[model samples]
Target chain A: AQSVAQPEDQVNVAEGNPLTVKCTYSVSGNPYLFWYVQYPNRGLQFLLKYITGDNLVKGSYGFEAEFNKSQTSFHLKKPSALVSDSALYFCAVRDHRDDKIIFGKGTRLHILP
Target chain B: GAGVSQSPRYKVAKRGQDVALRCDPISGHVSLFWYQQALGQGPEFLTYFQNEAQLDKSGLPSDRFFAERPEGSVSTLKIQRTQQEDSAVYLCASSSTGTNEKLFFGSGTQLSVL
Candidate 1:
């Protein structure tokens, strides 16, 4: 079974400061990792995905994620945070056998002004 | 015209009532998926369909939950004997063939069971 873990329940950062949201996963084989953002009462919007490529993957809204193979981590990062960037972030990993994607609980990101 | 769409943006059902949520995937999309997201939680996979064929449904919470994609275009998720625990936002998404393609999501249908 494949699963994802987002250790933090919530993360707070100031506007214009760098931000990081941690994510880790457990899978049997090569993993397909993804990041998605969900605003209140809205469906999830895709942010980025890491298939097989360079470690750093850039995504929408000036966000990026680093795929660390050894650590089993795909942490989302942003150079500078904005108040509008505050939302719930989710990490997901697709199962190799069935292609069923499992998502982490999610982390609430709050940007302080 | 290009994105996935779901109908009944909000629904309020009394306990034991039945409700149906609809989804229309993008044209020519081969894969469709249904997910349930509780408040403040990530969406969990409820089922998947490849065109008109229902391939996987292991994530569905109970036997009362049912979904179908007849004719390979529009899909519907029906819940019988709705319970309070079933109250959640149901999201529908679709993607083209190939493993690396990103999924396009609909706004979702929020269900409130009383």
Candidate 2:
């Protein structure tokens, strides 16, 4: 089976400070990784995805994630945190053999001003 | 119209009552999906439809859950004999292709079973 793990339930970062939200995955075949953000009382919004090439993938809102094959990790990062970046972040994976995407429990990010 | 649209943003149902949730996908989207999200958890896949075909229903929790996209544009998910465990946010998403690409999601219908 395929699964995603987000180690942290909540991450707090000060404004203008760098932030990182960790994610790891397990899949039988190749994995399609993605990041999504959800604000309170709203639906999830797509952030970025890592399909094949370029381990470093850039996403919306000045966010990026590095895909490490050996580590089986895809950690979302931002150079500087903003108060508006506070939201729930989810890491998802889709196995090549399946059409369904599985998501992690989600990490709540709080950017303190 | 501009994005995936779901009806009845909130629904309250008594135990043993049946409820129907509706979804209207984006124009020309070929793939639609239904997901259930419990409190503080990620969305769980309930079913998938390609056009008018019900391609996958493996993630459905029980036989009481039924979903269909008759004309291939709008879809409905009906739950019979509602239980407290079934109380969650039912999310509807769509993509242009059949593959599980970047999906556009609706605000979702928050269901509460008493």
Candidate 3:
């Protein structure tokens, strides 16, 4: 019943350029959203979460995400991309009543130097 | 303290064989979870344990999958009758109590079914 969609499978960006990876969700109740990053052959690391906070939530590695309740969207953004930022990005949403987290398909980000 | 740790970083199992994956959570974490992640996809929840209690097993794909946390600190996930579809990375995560807590994940065991 609850799910998240990441429209793009891959996102390409140049170093020093701003980047955005899109995410949207469908849930029955209020959403507790989060973003995580995974490097090749490694476990996912938490990036940020939005649980009843300002529209824009800042996270690790100079990354941030904007939570738009009306759009049902939580797109991860970075002011300037770095080569080290290239990795798989996942968007997850947890319903208020359930601890089960539904994650998006994930986006592979490539930051070209 | 150390973060969540899962072992045998890699496992190779023949079809129909059984395998066990282990996870050691942070010393005081109360919620432990098991998830399966296929290549290029997000991790899918398998089971959850609150301390030593198996509070949720709804996400487990089949009866062949069993998980337990006997003492509430370490847990193990056992899979039987392994199939090709069973090949994936098994990730374990843990968090403090309360539904909103952030999850800390382990490097995971990469299971390759032959």
Q: DockQ of every model listed?
A: 0.66, 0.78, 0.73
All candidates' chain B TM-scores are: 0.97, 0.98, 0.96
- CAPRI tier of model 2: medium
Give per-residue CA lDDT, model 3, range B1-114, as digits (tens): 578999999999999999999999989999998999998888998988889998879999999999999999999999999999999999999998757458999999999999
Model 1: per-residue Cα lDDT over A1-113, one tens digit each: 88899999999999999999999999998899999998876778999999887999999999999999899999999999999999999999985556577889999999999
- After superposition, the stretches of candidate 2 with alpha carbons farther than 4 Å from their true spots are none
On residues B33-114, what C-alpha lDDT tens digit does candidate 1 reach at each position? 9999898778899999988998889999999999999999899999999999999999999888736358889999999999
Judged by lDDT, which candidate is best? 2
DockQ for model 3 equals 0.73
Better of 2 and 3 by TM-score: 2
- Candidate 1: residue pairs that collide: none
Residue A30, model 1: Cα distance from true site in angstroms: 1.3
Tell me which of candidates 2 and 3 scores higher on lDDT: 2
After superposing candidate 3 on the true structure, give the runs of residues whose Cα lies further than 4 Å from its correct spot.
Answer: none
CA error at residue A65 for candidate 3, angstroms: 0.7
